[model samples]
Target: MKKANKLLKEIVVLIFALLFLSPIYIVFANSFKDRGELYESVLALPSSYSFQYYLQAMERMNFISAFGNSLVVTAVSIFFLVILSSMTAWMLARTNNKLSKIIFMSFIATMLIPFQTIMMPLIQFMDQIMRLTNIPMLNTHGGLIFMHIGFNSALSIFLYHGFITTIPKSLEEAATIDGCSKFMLFWKIVLPMLKPITVTVIILNVIQIWNDFLLPSLVLTSPGLRTIPLTTFYFFGQFTIQWNLAMAGLTLTLIPIVIFYLFAQKHIIKGIGEGAIK
Candidate 1:
């Protein structure tokens, strides 16, 4: 009976996996097809595979510019997030004061609140604050980066704090004995040891920032500055949706992330496992 149940569970899992992946399968299959072939057989392989649609998508989406923008935003935001959140987490983990504990709990509580709840207010504050202080936090790439830092910092800090707690203070004490300054100790010793959590933070933020639609859409008004997701929306209209082009665009958008995951997935898994072991 146990063996039968195990077999049944495997079958169920396989079915669900296929169910989730069917859309991706269809997208890839259709991407190589012309309009007529796509219309005729959305599920079937292309009569003869072609790259014309890929070329067309590249031209229409200004793939280079969009890709560059995404790269810049994702990289910059991740850099700031790692630096700021890791430092904050290290402090929170090391300090036993009541204020630090309270602050940490508040950050955890903030995570429970969905972005949608405060999104409108956030925009208003950015605009108003930028206007008042000349800080330029609206409808700009820099502005978007600032917003991402604020939104993502809490979660990054939480992850880093958890991982850092498991690290022994002996390392820091030894570094101090070697005449290491506080900054030097953190940069050289603590940060290197925090690699597992750093990888976790990078992977999570990359996926989130790369695929984020609402935040970018709300913050960036210029067509030239559109990220891949926002740019992909051009293929759809109120009356007609260009399914072929849209699918092609989506396929293009997924390529970088898929490639990233393929390469870094090892690191991601290793990091999570190491952190979990701690």
Candidate 2:
């Protein structure tokens, strides 16, 4: 009976796996075919496998530049996000005051608000600031970074705050008793202890900011500043779809993210597990 049940479970798992993978199979198969072949049979293997679509996408999207821009923006955003959020969360969790409570609650509240509702106002404020300060907040990488910092910081802080509360106050107290300064206490004791949550925050924000389209599109208007998603969009024309090339571009866009996750998969799982342990 146990053997039969195990076989049945295996069959179920295989079926569900195939169901989810069918679309990806179609994308891969169709990407090798020409436009006519794709229209005729989306799922059929190509009559002749060629890397033409990938080559075309690479040239058209200026692959190297797009890859570089994405790397720079994502790295900067993640750097600031991890630092600001982790530190803010540590402070908020350690301190007990009306101000800290209100600030923490405000971060949670901001997360509940939809981005679309604030899009126009955000753009206006940014425009005004640019005009007043001559900082060129619109149509620039810096603008995108600023927006990412604002939008992503609240979420990161919330995650950090939740995980920080699970840490023992005795750790900080012990550090203080040893004549450690407040900054030293955090850098030496708390930051090391918060490694799991920091990893969790990095993984989460990397996925969010890397794949995000709307905000980047709004802020980064120049073709030179285009990230992966925006670069993919250029493959679409007013009337033409270029499905094969589009799929190739999509594949290129997903590869970095996929590689990052594969390498960091263990840390990601451990971080999430530890973060939730409390």
TM-score of each: 0.88, 0.91
Per-residue lDDT of model 2, residues 1-278, tens digit only: 99999999999999999989788777778778888888898877889988988888888988889889988998999998888888898999988999999999998888889889999998999999988999999998878987898899887887788878876798789879989999998888888887877888888778788888899888888899999878777656521567788777767776787798799989877766654553
- Model 1 gets an lDDT of 0.85
Clashes of each: 0, 0
For residues 1-278, write the lDDT of model 1, one tens digit per residue: 99999999999999999989898989988878777887787899878877887888888888889999999999999999999999888988888999999999998899899989989998998889988999878878899998898888877888898888877899899888999998998898899998868998898788789889899989998888988888876544421456676677779988998899799989867766654454
What lDDT would each prediction earn against the true structure? 0.85, 0.84
Task: Name the lDDT of candidate 2.
Answer: 0.84
Query: How displaced is residue 51 in candidate 2, in Å?
Result: 1.0
TM value for model 1:
0.88
Q: State the displacement of the C-alpha of residue 136, model 1, in Å, after optimal TM-score superposition.
A: 1.5
